[model samples]
Target: MFKKSVLLYLLLAIGLVLAACGQSDQGSEDKSKEEETTQGNEEEKASEESGSESEEANDKEEDADFVAAYKEGKDELAKAGEGEEVDYQKVIDLYNNQLQPLVAERDGNIDQQISTALEAGKNGEMDGQVVKQIFDKLTQKVFYLTIKHEFQEIDENWGKKEEVNEEIAEAKEYYEVLKETVEKRDAAYETNMVDQIDAGFSEIEKAVENDDNLGFQLGKQVVDKTLMKTFYLAAGAVPNGYATKAAKEAEEDPDKAKVEQAEGWAFYQSISEYITKYAEEDAKIIEKNFNLETDVKELDPEAVNHAFVRGLSKVALHEYEESEEYWGEDKSAITALEGALFIDMIASDIKRMQGEDAYNTLNEQAQTYLDAVKSDEKEKAMEVLEKIEGTLNSIIEKAK
Candidate 1:
């Protein structure tokens, strides 16, 4: 009986050991499968990320190519305006080959304009200079508005640092194309517009680095208003602007004056929305005065000119009001700077009408208000702000 019991115990122990070995093998196989799945998922994710990066790079390259093509087309057309013999067939072919596809992609009224202008050029129906102005200035308007659109995207994606930074970069790229236009205006007008715009862009960069939304907002306003100032200089800022040029040439050379008027209208469209925001009636009047479709002989250059002054003056007043409302805060400084920028937009006109000394005094007071707001000196800011408002109001009244 004892021998039989020992045999039974040995068999049971053997059975338990075999079961343990089976369970250990199963666990090991399961772990291997899990690790394989994890590796596969990581590889897939990496592939997707790489694809996305490749797409972004391709899109950027495409835009760069498009800008080059645009420049080539514009330059070719401008040569005709400069009295250089241009092969119309060559320009048409260039447009069809390079510009048409891209312009079609951005299809709008602008596409129609481009097509019509090119057709006219091909058929010898439009002057080359007019074609050049249309292409150059209209393309510029698109870039300016694109910069605005990018800023709106930045605002929408404010907390997403990478996304916001990307939008800012795009905005800067658009502005880069516009910098030449600003520089040209500066050369003609003897203004420090390029420096002002550069400072605004620098502020934008610094604000982004620090993740200060308000600073970014303020910086955007400066860049925006300064660009508006540049457009104003091109369109209506007296002595040298298209508005004045058109008026002076009207009696002597109606055709040339009409071209100048067209140029003024094209340039004004770039900043019309901003002006319309502050003074809709004035915007309408200005538009009517510059519109080529209107009776060119009956066009009132003075009305267009004064409307711009009134519109900008109203914008300044509105900004100062905003500054006053946001007192004791960063917003005050932002709007104050904007107000000052608008005033500076018409600085030459201000000096002309109010005299250089008065203009200087107003400029000084504006700087004081901006500084006071930044330093949190509410009393001083308010005092200077009131004076600024008074001056702006007087200017608006006179513009009427």
Candidate 2:
């Protein structure tokens, strides 16, 4: 009976051990299955993230292409406007062939970005941020292009009589306001300059009213000059010095002053001589209807060539005076001389092209200023500078 009881106990122990082993195996299998399922889910999530990134990258590329196209269109329009002659057909072609297409493409790109953002939002992705960024960039481009387009339109229609008339009227109104403003700023300000600007506005108005193309062209020059002056004044670009530092230095030291005064007189004399000679030559060229080929060896044989020569001469004189231990170089003088010379050249060419009478008138006015410079009177010389400026503007008008 004792042996039988021992055997039964052993059997029970064996059964319990088997049950524990089976439970362990089942738990291990379940843990392995869970790990495999988790890994598969992680891989799917990674693929989805990569796909979103790729879509975002594509959207950026399309947006970049649209911006580039718009910029290119703006540049082409600017180029067309800056041509020597406005080719209306070319402007039209550019708008039709390039600009319109770009506009359409840009619109499409905006729509696509918006649609993508909306779809992403619906899918519980980040919402509206992408659309906002695209809109911000597009708005900047559109604003800049719109301003450029307006200016191009003005340039394209500049030759039209109706457009010119409207421009002239607008200019006249602005001029009146400018005149009143100037008077308010400096009651003693030289009225001559203002009078000259007024005369320019009048000419533009008259030309447009008469429907005279040549006259209108001339009138445009006056309007352009007046506008430039208005812009300069509005921008506070007035010069700081009335005379060169060298001229000022002469006031402190008598000996140096004497020497500089003599040098200044010599410089003025040289400028006067050149002006007189050039004027005579220019008159002849105009009389010949600018048919004579220019001889560069001669001191500006043609009026058209005088601008650069005169500018260089003035710069050289200023540099020389400044280098004589009197003062540092006067950049303002150099800039002023260059600007004047440029205006003079443009005016001279226009006058010469217009006819002999116009050319002669410009030459005569220049001669008057040169003669005034020779007078050696400071006030008179300064006055002549103003007069020369006004006369040059007049020549530009007549030449047009």
Candidate 3:
């Protein structure tokens, strides 16, 4: 009887141990699956967080009310060309009904210009083709300025992720409308500006995602300054600018040169405010020389070109000055990048004025300074920045 009881207890103990072991194995499998699921979820989240210009554009809401109205007006005007009999009354009605209200809400100046252009076209005071060009270019300017306004809104609404994201989307949409002009300049100058601008937009989206205000500011400068550079190239940059074209044509065909000068003047309006902010006198000279009211034969492309170089050099120097003041911080890095971009705006002219070797040296020094700023190497950054400043001062004097 004692042996029987002992054997029975031993058999019950073995059964309990086997059941526990089976549960342990099942729990281990469950844990392994949970870890794999967590890792996969993290990876998927990372993939969604990555952004691009196209992605931002895709995320944007459909065109705004003004955008639709502007497009409709543009289409209506497109039918009016050189020597083509246009329904002037129809264009007037379209502007009054569709564009005028939106322009008034957006910008009073734009409203006046559109109204003036429409009246001039209706009265036969301006050529139909000229009127159309004015209409399109002026509207494009409004779009560009709206982008700036959107950035300001983003800054104001910082930390409100939804509002900030919406503003960014709006800005991206406006940029898309202006992209053709960027592409045209890139093709003409053989520069990769479109890529630069796209990278800037990407930086902006990433900054927004990370909730980094300084990063957003830095990205904004990249996009803003690059677009400014585009307009500068259109207006007065060497080798292929309207100023150069106008000068070349002036001697052979004054009328055609006038048209080119007018184009330069129109494009210059985009960057004139920035130039004026830094170098008022230089801005005045540029504006006067490129003024449509000024005869093409009287326009001095050389003087206009020189003024642009001087003004931009001053602007670059100011950026470096700000970088110096904000040393050892992200602002320093931001201004350093701005200084480099401003220098790059006149790179072709720099290469022409200072030999290629000299321009290369300057570029290398600028890049070194930027790196030092980013790394928080105050002394090294200051040393390189001073050298860059001195070189720019010399360039400014020569430009005079």
Candidate 4:
């Protein structure tokens, strides 16, 4: 009976071992399957990323090819000259050959349409030139459409165009009137009596207000006329000797640039006032733009030019301080500096050779001017230094 008990015990131990082995095998199999799943997911992600990269590369190549082909077509057309048409199909065929790989990569979608257009052109079965013209027209249409949308996007952009139009109109309509008014009676202007000017001085009043978009058409014409006047004014302001010389050669030889700058300022100023007056809805755009300019300071006793020029002026005035903030050390900032430190060094040398008094005076004036610029007290600083400068100028003239 004891022998039988021992054998049963042994058999039970064997059964337990077999069951444990089965569980171990199952766990191992599960681990292997999990590892395979992770590897598969990683492989799929990599494949997708690589495919996307390949697609982007192909797209870039396709765009470049298209540009090249378009340029080539243009060159060929130019060679064909005026009143002559080139073989559109021939150009299309050439472009298709260059685009084969790009189309194949895109699963032959856009490429297929291009191929069809080219083949049809080749056969001369259609006005092949029409196809090229269609594409050219589309390109121009796209550009103009983009500009139209841009004008919509920024209210300021639209205002600029509108302001330009308004100025042009005003100059053409009222410029002659003001001039004629002054011409009729120069005494009022000479005596600073601008308020006592006549309303009726120049240009014939229309007999009748015609229908058929007269206002719209007149608006455009007025803008164009204003544009011509503004052009003359701007041309006067250009410091180019060529422009100045050309003006001097003209019958009414005037400094075009100064005239133009003055006229532009007047025109823009009037437009600004008009916009502030009648264009309440549109003026909001100008206000938004005005707010966006970080450096623009609205000085109460100044005109727009002084106000407009100040934004850049202030930044320039504070550049040295701003630069210190941008770079903790001078190494980076020093590399991008754009002026002549040598000029200051030369001036220092001159002062040393002359005397302490000359150097002291130069340093004092420079320091005062720099301090004034920093303090935004330019006008006061100028008043203080004007006599000093005049004295120095006279002294130098006597020495010369």
Candidate 5:
């Protein structure tokens, strides 16, 4: 009986061991399957993200290509307008070799149409009307680019406060007008206006070269005025033949000539109001900020010129009296004070030789001018202006 009981115990132990092995194998296989599934899902998600990034990149590339093509076309058109012969074949080659491939990827028809136009133009099969149409299309493209470029330029430079605040404001105003003019460009006047703008840009470049802020401001003003004239022309505010008529009338009638002269002066006054109003403020800022002892040689000629012109204009218009409002109870107006300060700063050595009394006399004369203008005494103001001019010239001569 004891031997039979031991055999039963051994059989039960063996059966339990086999069951445990089966369960271990099953768990291992299930875990392997889950890992494979998880890996596959992760790979799919990564691939999808990569595809989205690629698509976005391609879209941006296409936009850049479009802008480049438009700029190229407009540049070519501008060259033609300048009497340069248009190389239609070269343009066609560029389109086919570079631009068309980009368009092809997107299934666009623009490249094909442009190719056809260039071929037609090259073969001399296109009529004047067709040529005009092509040029017009190109000009329109240029207009868009001009607006974009100008706005970008302004935004980039707007933060640079190396210039006076008033000058910066004027530049912003001019840029705004230019943007609007480009947006609403009349087809008939496009070439003329663009030419004017280009000329103004040249002047601005010159101003930059000379380090003259006032010149830059005036150049930009010219561009603004040109754009305004173009706008007015398109709106028929000025008569179609007004220029010729005005010219002839000036030649024929003295009275008509005087009227036109007065009209011109009125226009000048209207446009220069801002300059007149801010001249004193600018001078005050300069006075407060600039250290004449250290910065005398480095003084901005443009600022000095701006102040000089403001004073000259006021005197010419018999509006010197109005400038007193800017002075309040101050002994001297801003321009006179600025001029005297400039002399003191630039000619300190000469001032030392001439004694303090001479300098005091100069200040007194400037004060006298301010008093004369405040009292509406034109004759006295004129006399003071002449004396001031002579004294300033003498000081400048001595400094040299």
Candidate 6:
């Protein structure tokens, strides 16, 4: 009985060993299969990402190229607007053949901008920022192309914009019409410096088209500040009835505004000669390469300065007592214009900062006062007001 029991126990031990070996082999095989499957999934994910990235890059390149073409074409159009020195006909051809076609050929770029925007989302792919960028670029391209095409048409029709035609009838200078009051004035012809201006204006426009800065300057110096001031002073002195009529017409009709402003700028340029000619050393600068036979008379730079000071002061006081309230968004533009007016005043003032138009200085001080208030300095604000009062008193004394 004892021998039989031992034999049965040995058989049972062998069967148990076999079962353990089978389980170990099954676990190893299962782990190997799982690793292979994971690797395959990783490679598929990587390929999808790379393909998406490639598509995105291609889209950006296409959009960028379209914008570039639009800009190049538009610059040519500006040259035409100033006066056609460029081959605007060629520009038109390029636009129709190149820019418009290229943009249209971008294969539904609007959809792509939208896709990119949607994919990015607002909270990290949620907002419409991407779509807006694409839309804005397209809008800009459309506008740029439209303006260029219109300008090209103008060139085709008008042949080129003309600045002044001696044959056409022109209104007389306001200064010449009212030479009595506001003393130290010279303009007498109702037709302000036409011959003096006509010769140079067209050339200046031409020089700009050719990218010749010096030539532009030579032409510019002829009528920029001096001639404009002359016209302004002349306009100020015009018979009250005509002056009111001119101002009223300026607001109602843009056509009249264009002509009047051009005439004003022309006289302003002539005025520069009054001050610059007196600085005999500057004659070389005035006569650089282009022989400007401007028979500029000598006037006290101080007188011109005073005129600019008083006139501009009135303009500023009228428009900008509280600048932020009136022109908040464009305050910087106003400040820059003020700086330019100051330069005009001082350059004209020359040696007589005292007797000259001190109005520019006082005007600057007023702007400074406005700036201080904007800065929230109440104590300094009072001081600024007092300084302005003192400056005005001094200005009044100088005028006397």
Overall lDDT per candidate, in order of appearance: 0.74, 0.35, 0.75, 0.32, 0.41, 0.36
- TM-score of each candidate structure, all chains considered together: 0.79, 0.24, 0.78, 0.22, 0.27, 0.24
Point out the worst 10-residue segment of candidate 6 by lDDT.
16-25
Models ranked on lDDT:
3, 1, 5, 6, 2, 4
Q: Which is the better candidate, 5 or 6, if ranked by TM-score?
A: 5
Worst 10 residues of 2 by lDDT: 16-25
After superposing candidate 1 on the true structure, give the runs of residues whose Cα lies further than 4 Å from its correct spot. 1-41, 82-107, 123-125, 157-166, 294-300, 326-332, 375-379
**Candidate 6 TM-score, C-alpha based:** 0.24
Q: Ten consecutive residues with minimal summed lDDT in candidate 3?
A: 16-25
Per-residue lDDT of model 3, residues 1-400, tens digit only: 0133332332232111101001111112122222358788787556545543445455352346566666776666767644467776787787787667545555565566567666666776655654565567667766777777778778777997876888887888888878988999999988888899888888888988999888888888888888888889989988688888888898898766766775787677677766888899999898778765566778888888899999999999998999899887788888898999999999888888887887898999999998898787888888887889888998998888
Question: Could you give candidate 1's per-residue lDDT for residues 123-161 as a string of tens digits?
Answer: 666667766676777677666766766676677668877
lDDT of 2 by residue, 34-139 (tens): 3358788787677766865676466446444544544443343333224332233433344345344433332333333333322332343322222222222232
Model 1 lDDT, full chain set: 0.74
Tens-digit lDDT track of model 6 for 22-125: 11111121222233587887876676668656754664464455555555654543442354455444544554554555433322332233233223322232
Clashes of 1: 0
Q: List the residue pairs that clash in candidate 3.
A: none
lDDT by residue for model 5 (279-385), tens: 44533332221211112223333343334333323332232333434444332343343343333322223345456677677668766875675565767877877
| Number of backbone-clashing residue pairs for each candidate, in the order shown | 0, 0, 0, 7, 0, 24
TM-score result, candidate 1: 0.79
Q: Which ranges in model 3 have alpha carbons more than 4 Å from their true place?
A: 1-65, 75-81, 101-106, 251-255
RMSD of 1: 23.5
